[model samples]
Target: MRVEQQPGFVLHARPYRETSLLVECLTRDHGRIGVVARGVRNERARLQRAQLEPFQRLELDLLLKGELATLRGAEPSGAVMRLTGDAGLAGLYLNELVVRLTGRQDPNPDLFAHYERTLRRMAGGEPLAWTLRRFERDMLDALGYALQLDIDANSGEPLDPSIRYVYDPESGASPGRPGDPHGLRGADLLALAEDRSPDVAGLSSLRRMMRQVIAFHLGGGELRAWRVLR
Candidate 1:
């Protein structure tokens, strides 16, 4: 399939054989795609090297062949973020999440929009924690593994604001009964599910619960960018 001027964002890119590059891009229509940018390493190549960075919108031209496509040309579709300080690190974390979680060539328009919004928020120096958490939840939902947040997973009732609960990665939130593992307070879990800015204590518990859930889906491997951000 040949595509002309498709809107997309570069997820990742690395040097390939000789002067080519293996680029992964997320598109609005085609979802995630892998392309081999031939001769991109040449100094005289028409493609602007700067346009290939993460979070920069681009219009890509390519011809698909099996799993990999041949990039014919590329041009920046909008202004690229010059992320600095903490914001830059947060942007990297977001990119890493997309690279790891999203399947290649799978279309998810909602996820694509959420990702663009997350990048814009990060670049604007907004609070990264809240945005990251919200995006994580949205991403999980888009991938058909949305977390159970409104009611107790075991009890099948609305979460109690006054009681504590255990947030199980496999089963979601449950009453924090005796001998329950991975339990957080019902209030705190509810706060996180609602995307509210919780207090320090609440944030701590929410973070632990989110990390467990994410790690379980990621095959127990930790996000490397998390360490850098910390």
Candidate 2:
């Protein structure tokens, strides 16, 4: 089937055979898609680049068969969002996450919308930590692993800002267990839960909590872009 003028972004791309490019794209309606952009590297082509680069929204035409699709045409769908410094790195990290978590041809339009909004937020110079935390929470929520940050897991009550709680990926937040070395303040978790920007300590706690949740799902596979941010 020939899919025409789909909204998407190039999540990743690389050189293909002598004159083509292998491109991985996240489409608004089609989820993560891999396309063979044939002849993109050839001198006669207008794109000139071997592959469409990351961080740009695009309208794409794809020829679908089975696993890999043939790229018929591609053009910028909207203005390219220019992200620099931490924002740029963050964008790469997001792309990697979507690439890893989503399957080809699965429609995840809401997640696609979330991705676009996050890029806009990042490009607008929103604080990296705050932006990252929110994105992590939303991404996890979309994937059905959303953290129970607003309430207690054991008591089933709204979290009090002053209390401390242990976070279990499967069980959500609960009053700190005896001998628990690591826990988050209800203030901090509630701030995260409400999507409020956190203080330095709270942000740190959020980072740790998000890392734990994401790592649990990933089964300890490392996030390479995360290391670059360090």
Candidate 3:
């Protein structure tokens, strides 16, 4: 299939053969895809190679045949996102999540939009913890693992903010044993569920909870980006 000027972002790229690159991209309509960028590593293709970096929106021309699409051309489509320090690491984490969780050619417009918005927000200096947690929630939902936040898994009742709950990765939240230090506050869980502004403590709670959920869904393998961001 031939695609023209497909809007996308490079999620990862590695050297292929002598002068080519194997690029993974997330596109608006095509989800995650692998493409072969032939000869982009050569000195003459420096300009084209530069356009394949992460966090920059691009218009890609592709020729899809077998397993890999041929990257016919690429051009920046918007202002390049220049994130630094922790923000930069967060951006990388986002890319890694997309690469690992999304299936090739499975179109998810909402996920794509969430990813773009999160990157933009991170680049604009939004609080990292909140921004990343929101994206993680959206990403999980898009992938069909929506968090069960409103009800207690054990009792099947709405959450009580004053109570503490133990979250089971597959079963959701249930009331915790009294004074269990590891239990997360129902208030913080509710805040995350409602997308309300969470205080520092709430943000911390949500972060730990999200990490557990994401890691569980990833089948126990920790994300390299998460390790780096720590």
Best by TM-score: 3
Question: Roughly what TM-score does model 1 have, to 2 decimal places?
Answer: 0.92
In the range 1-230, model 3's lDDT, one tens digit per residue, is 99999999999999999999999999999889999999988989744688898999999999988778999889899898899999988889999998888889998988999999999999899899999999999999998999998799988999999998988889999999997766888998888899986789778778888888888888887899877877
The estimated TM-scores of all candidates read 0.92, 0.93, 0.96
Count of residue pairs whose backbone atoms collide, per candidate: 1, 0, 0
Error of 2 at 49 (Å): 2.1
Q: Residue 58 error for model 2, in Å?
A: 0.5
lDDT assessment of candidate 3 = 0.89
Name the weakest run of 10 consecutive residues (lDDT summed) in model 1.
176-185
Worst 10 residues of 3 by lDDT: 43-52
Error of 3 at 178 (Å): 3.2
Best candidate, lDDT-wise?
3
Residue 124, model 1: Cα distance from true site in angstroms: 1.9
lDDT of 2 by residue, 85-166 (tens): 7788899999988887777888888888889899989888889899889988898887777788898888899998988888
| lDDT (Cα atoms) of all candidates against the true structure | 0.83, 0.85, 0.89
Which residues of candidate 1, in runs, are more than 4 Å off? 177-182
> Which 10-residue span in candidate 2 carries the lowest summed lDDT?
45-54
Q: List where candidate 3 sits over 4 angstroms from the true fold.
A: none
